[model samples]
Target: MSALLELRNVSRSFGGIHAIRNVSLTLQPGQIVGLIGPNGAGKSTLVNIITGVHPATSGTIVHKGERIDRLKPFQISARGIARTFQVVQPFPSMTVIQNVMAGAMFAANIRSMDEARSVAMEHLTFTGLAAMADRPAEQLTLANRKRLELAKSLAMNPHILMLDEVNAGLNTSEVEQALDLIRAIAARGISIVIIEHLLKVVTGLCSRIIVLHHGELIADDPAADVIKDPRVIEAYLGSKFAQRQMVRHG
Candidate 1:
């Protein structure tokens, strides 16, 4: 099957420094893939390029077989690609539901406020923010705010949802809850690209994984095998991690 999203030889540079270089990736329909690396690894930069937050310095980004590299952010979003930020940025003045309603408004079919509200409520309920839907976005706890972020993105009716550090600040139970929610989302046939620092989360949630280091693509394989890759260990997961793994298995 054709890839839902494709990045070909994609690179982005700031001044003389390359933040991403010669990176190519593909996301298949209904697949949940992990994009992982340490800080400064250009994961966000690649997401920005895909979402059109910034233009690529050199290469092509295709979504649903159409070229979107030159498109505007909203244009790309309109075409069914949505993303949640690493830093939650809810509309402080809006109620939790209202913040989600704003995202629902992006759907071309959601013409009336009533329709948007209904759509928003479904996403809010799905994300477990239904109980707090009436509260101001700023009043939510870190975990709730993150749920709100997911709800808002879900409101967009995206085909490919890219989540940037969705589990960043959650407690263990909350992380498990988020994992279940993400699995539900993927079960509904939406392709997901998760950018996470938590290797366990990636290992648990993703079937395929992509690893980046020093702004370059270093590995892409099944989650189990990728973690054992020497290049990945050298670049991010150090030797001590492997030693612990060996001890556990042996």
Candidate 2:
């Protein structure tokens, strides 16, 4: 099967500083991939580049065989690439379902309000936010806000979903709930690239793991192999700790 998305030697810079350097990777259809790194490893920058929030300074981004590096964010969303931000920002004044309806109208091209509402309700129900559909977005708890973010993204009819720290602020039980919802999403055949700091979450949920360090791609391997890699260990831990791990394992 063809790749769902491809980034070839992709790099991004802000004036004198390079945020991402020559990172190349591919997302296969129906796969859940973990993107992990220490803080300032450029994980969010890479996501921005993919979703067109920040275009790559050099390299190509291809989705379904078509180049999209230069496309605007809305254009990319319309082409079925959707992302949720690390910081959930909903239209505070809008009702829960109305916020999702905007995504349907904007990205899914649903013009009629009735049809948009139908699509939004389906996504809200799927995300377990149906009971809160009429509530104002600002009134939600942190967990529910995250669910709202997911519902809005799903209403976009995405083929690929890039989640940036979707489980960041949740408690353990809430995180578990989010994991189940994510699994259900992947079951529907939407490819997922989840950026997470929680190693257990990544290892348990993703088939593959990609690690980045200091703006470079250091490791791309199966989840089990990645966690054991010395380079990955050093990136997250320290060089001294990584050496101890290597010697102990050997």
Candidate 3:
């Protein structure tokens, strides 16, 4: 099967500073891929590039055989690419259901308010936020806010979902719940790219892992192999520790 999304030698620079350099990867259908890196490793920048928040300075992004490197963010969303921010930015005054309805109406192109509401309700229920649908978005707890973000993304009817730090602030049990929800999403055949800092979360939830460091792609492999890679180790723990491991092993 063709890839759901492909990035070819993609690079993005802000003036003289490179945020991402020569990174290329693919997201296959129904796969959950983990993107892990140290702070300032360009993980978020890479997501932004894919979502068109920041367009790539070079290289091409193809989704389902169409080049999308030049498309506007809304255009990208209309094509079934959706993403949630690291920071949840819901419309605070809107009801939870209304916030999701916006996504349905705008990105999914639902023309009627009633139709959007119906679609949004399905996603809210799927994300476990149906009980809170009538509440103002600002009234939610952090975990619920995250769920709201997920529901809104689902309302867009996405083919590919890139979740940036979706598990960031949750406690252990809450994270587990989020993982289950994510798995259910993948079961529907949506390709998922998760940007996470938690090694355990990444390893347990994703079949494949991609590592980035200092604006470059360093490792892309299965979870088991990626965790053992010296470059991935150095990216997380510094060169001295990586050297010590190599010496101790050999």
TM-scores for all predictions: 0.96, 0.96, 0.95
What 10-residue stretch in candidate 3 is worst by lDDT? Answer: 237-246
Whole-model lDDT values for every prediction = 0.92, 0.95, 0.94
Q: Candidate 2 deviates by what RMSD?
A: 1.5
Clashing pairs in 1: none
Displacement of residue 3 (Cα, Å) in model 2 is: 1.1
lDDT of 3 by residue, 208-238 (tens): 9999999999999999899779788977757
Ranking of all predicted structures according to lDDT, beginning with the best and ending with the worst? 2, 3, 1
lDDT of 1: 0.92
Residue 90 in model 1: shift from native, Å?
Answer: 0.6
Count backbone clashes in candidate 2.
0
Top lDDT hit:
2
TM-score of 3: 0.95
Report clash pairs, candidate 2. none
Expressed as tens digits, the lDDT of each residue in 178-233 for candidate 1 is 89999999999999999999999999999999999989999999999999888898
Per-residue lDDT for 169-237 in model 2, tens only? 899999999999999999999999999999899999999999999999999999989978878987885
